[model samples]
Target chain A: MTQSLPSASGTPNPCIELSNVSKSYGLVPALSNLSFAIPEGGRYALLGPNGAGKSTTLKLLIGSLRPDSGRVSILGSPPDSRAAKAEVGYLPEDALPYRMLSVRENLEYIGSLRAVGDLKNRVDYLLDALDLREYERSNVGRLSRGNTQKLAIALAIVHSPKVLLLDEPLNYLDIPTQEKVIAMLESLQGTHLVSTHIMSIAGRLTDSVVMISKGTILWKGAIDELKRMGSPDEPIEKIVARMMTGAI
Target chain B: MLFRVLKFVLRTRFSRPFLGFILLMIFYSIVISRAIPPTGISVIISYYIVGIVAFFLAMSLATGGVMVMKSDRDFLFTLPLSSRDLSIAIFFSQFIAYGVTVLLLFAYLSQAFSSALLLVDLVALALTLTSLGTIAPSMTTKGRVSASVLLALWTSSALLKFPFTPGSAFSGSVVYGTATLVVLAAATVTIAFRNLPHVELDMVKSMVRSSSSEIKAPNSYVGKSPVSAIYFMNLSNMSLAGRFNMAGTARYVSKRVKSTWVAAIASAGAAAYVAFILIAYGAVHFSAAPLPAQIIANVILGFLAFAFSQSAITYERIWLSLTSLPPATYFRNLIAAKVLSLMLILAPFAVADAALAYLGYAGALASMVVVAVVIPGFFVLEVCWAAFTAPIQVKGDDMLMPAQFNLRQMAAAVPLVAVMGIAASASGVLDIALIGGLAIWVVSASLAVSGGFWNSVVSRLTESGFV
Candidate 1:
């Protein structure tokens, strides 16, 4: 029953690390003795079924939730430490910005807090890049869900953080916006860990996958390696499902 | 079928702690009836009752909607029950929802009225409250506001010694007042029942109309540093009326008006209140001091501060705020900004206090200190205390949903109430009020500024699922 995970990446240094981490919400275990790492600049997906602790892992790395046991670090610093927080950008699942603030204000407020240089220019750049210029003055409460998602994405990368942690980043986005976001995320130079249930999203956004089930690692490897587990024509989803359910 | 649905709804919607709160209120009412002399009920108390009822009626009309959860929308609305039966069930649900306020209002006053008359008035008030709340959704916003204003004017007629007004029964016009309320309650309940089935459709219409209306551009915080941005944004963007607890501690973004407007309105209200004090005690009872006015103003300010402070962090997204700066730095600035915003609202009252002092009221100087320095300082402690205890995460929009109250949430409110009690007791004494308020402010400021304290607070907040 010892399922092996390949070494995190070809690169040597880990920008994000979780060592023997275990977490729970009351009696329900989220992650038990879960250990993993993404090398510096590694782009990887934390793939899992619902309740497989994907979000918890991300929360732990972002320092919103502490593990019941073991260690979590970002860039070799404690995740909650200012140094690590400075280096990491995060997008929570179903994220809502300040309802009272306009889109432009939200960006500028957070940008200024993060000490982004020439923040007004940075905010303008983000508005234009994300096609949010038309609605930059719109209150976040009034934006359509897709535009809100776009704003959330813009907020995540507003400071050009060195490590991005995105949970279901494509959620509520249109196909075109998803493509735009994917391209935007790909163009950014940093390590990325995307937590998602969609296999296609994993394949598209990241080269490698860390599959988890019931709060433990089920398998971890490059998506190509995962695909090779089945016949060439097998849908990546079917392959992922089989592995997730222990049918493979 | 109606009975079945009512039973199901109550069982599902009423938490055990809320039931406990109701039971406790009943017990406290019994104690109050035994301890307090009922001789204090007089003509002035009757006018106060009219004001209280009018306030609740306006509130019910302004914020009313059927309490529908996503689950209820999916299942309860789609049920096969007859429309009449379903409507009755929803009406009863709304009654229970509004009954908490009724219970709180009547808990101490139950000894004043005869049991039979008390029962009649209680039933009448509860029925009117629930009926207006239920009927509100079917009316347009303009219609609702106009109706509320007209009704308020009519209600205030009772102050002129009008017969059969809702407050007239309490004002010593027993038979006619009772008759009027009974008829009004019957008519409103019937209308509410008839309108209940159309709530979903009306809600849709109202939402569409609201969304399609022109949205005014909000003020930009464009080149300001983070601290100033937090300060000004919290000041200008937030509304005293917009903050409500029904939706897991979220604020209504649509209700926001400029802080200048809020300040102006508040000043006018403060002036009116001062006028009321001068008219009642100064002009009418020339021998009596305005001690009650001073106490009421201070206590009211404290209560409003507590209410505003609840949303200080409830609407915050940790990923955005905390990750941008260290927790201590972010929250210290956040609390300071909120305190400053509260102080802006307090400025008018502070001016009112000074005016009161200039007019030679004995305790007005003490009241001024409480308003200017004490409450704003208490505001800082209140915000940090809320973050420490009962930091509820606000998810997506659920403005129409009823708040799921629990004992823990009730516990979180107790300390503030206790502080208000202290202020009420010591408001007449300047040295005690000033020293006590400053002591609280110093302790709160020390805790707020400490990096270690914030680290622990952030940990607790995350553990409580504030993310």
Candidate 2:
């Protein structure tokens, strides 16, 4: 019953695909001739160093940017199409909730628009799960950074989207909250594409890796496969550092 | 301690320009005094003191008066400076800077420094200003004043009334006023010095999270269908717009406006303007009201409209969340909603004024119809222009870009002027309505085509990292 995808393994048609897609801002090129795909329900991490076009790639996938050339599709339609938008839940790096809205209000507004069935129950569940009940009525502006991050997470998953694109999903959260978020995210159903420089986050959240550097996919495969690419006794991080720096 | 404070203040160069400006004005006053009549001294001195106080108050408010105190506290606290020196340093710097400014202003009234009592009063006034400026940032009040023109206007309005002047120098009112200022100055300075270690940052953000969270806002195509009740429920503050379903946009904006009380004041001012028109035309001797009053009323309305519409253009952070909704639907509703709120705020007043004044109900209806044609029509074009030009900077680190050259605004103004020209040339209300209807078609068509244009601009804005 496995779906076919147009990736390196040649599974069924990919849930997400970029075909020779390139994007740039002014003269500063972000992605060049970049192509990758993820089969339906694939859990992959987008790995790169700083300035490696990781953010730009996620933005393109979310239809926040149009590729300068070539094509990008999510769930078989254009990334910006209504179908794609409905299914995609994104947590941008350092995402901010609406400062003026109270915590419960923010959750309700997004949840209602997402048109989740029994939205009140779902919103209530998220509120309890995130330990946000204490400050539910307080404006997001008054919340501490960690609480704001929690609210943002709640907003992202409000729709129970089928495709989750997270950039540093655990950012600004304390250790206990991080663990809770990890567990909560693990429980969701989707093709999860997490972009992070932190290997621990990647290792825990995803089984497959799409290692990119200089806006191009350098290596991509199972996490175990990525580990084996290093020397016999070498640590995985050193291997990633080498690959990112072109020392591999 | 005095020398050290002076040296430190001088090294900062903060006071150099202020001192220099006061000196230059003083020199001008000295030269001009010989030709000045003594009779105007009372008026001139009154204006001078009030002007100087307002100039500094507005500036202090704008800067939050935090930079100097923060810099000094951080710099000198680690050094061997005592709290006394710190307070004195802060107070003296403030006192001397403002004292010199007032003295120079007073010079504009008289050829010399006036009297010893006047000098002391000036010192008290300057000290009062310094204290007021210092304590303001601690209140951590919310005032989103980014517009320079409005700031200047607010500052100048301080001269509208003054209780005491040099004319009343020996009067009891002058003594009481001076005493009150002195007491206030003393209390604020003491409190500020006590709480020098703690200062709150002015971090007031937008109270309106969004204009609307509706999945669909009505447009010419899909909007032809009836709206659901859920659509109205999502509106943050305002009531449902009957039939048109513009409530979501109006409510969100109205709520945001309520949060920022400046909008409320502007609206109230508009109401007062309406009343004045009613009173003048209906109750007074005049056949028609003065041109200045109408012009001023319109200016206030224009200001409110601009202020009310600012959110539509400056939705940088909100843009990310709004992307989930259909762009064309949201923006169209947004433009319509922005203009609707302005129309709601202002049109009633204009209509009332027209009916109550010499023009009567026909003129009122005519004006209302013309406004219906013009306000939303022009605002759609203007909002699109403003959206591309103005980028709301999210707090921390990033600096807001100065207002950009608004080509779309200039382009939009052409049709507005054309409509007004037609109104001027038209013989009757019917003629104006006919011309307005023609303009509406053009504006509606532009709004329809503007979807692609807005998408392009938003994409560019996103790429530029404004959000």
Q: If you assessed candidate 1 against the hidden native complex, which CAPRI class would it receive?
A: acceptable
**Candidate 2 lDDT, B422-458, residue by residue in tens:** 4333213546655665675576547545767666766
- For model 1 chain A, where is the 10-residue window of minimal lDDT? A1-10
Q: Is the docking of candidate 2 incorrect, acceptable, medium or high quality?
A: incorrect
Give model 2 RMSD, 1 decimal.
Answer: 9.5
Using TM-score as the measure, the top candidate is 1
Residues forming the 10-long window of minimal summed lDDT in candidate 1 chain B: B245-254
Every model's TM-score: 0.92, 0.68
Off by over 4 Å in 2: A1-10, B1-134, B140-235, B238-271, B280-286, B313-320, B357-379, B395-449
lDDT of 2 by residue, A127-223 (tens): 9999988877775656788998898888888878888999998889999999999999998888999999889899989899998888888988999
Q: Scored by Cα lDDT, where does model 2 land?
A: 0.58
Model 1 C-alpha lDDT per residue in residues B275-371, reported as the tens digit of each score: 9777777754423277778788888888788777776776788879988778888899888877877777788888887887787766777778888
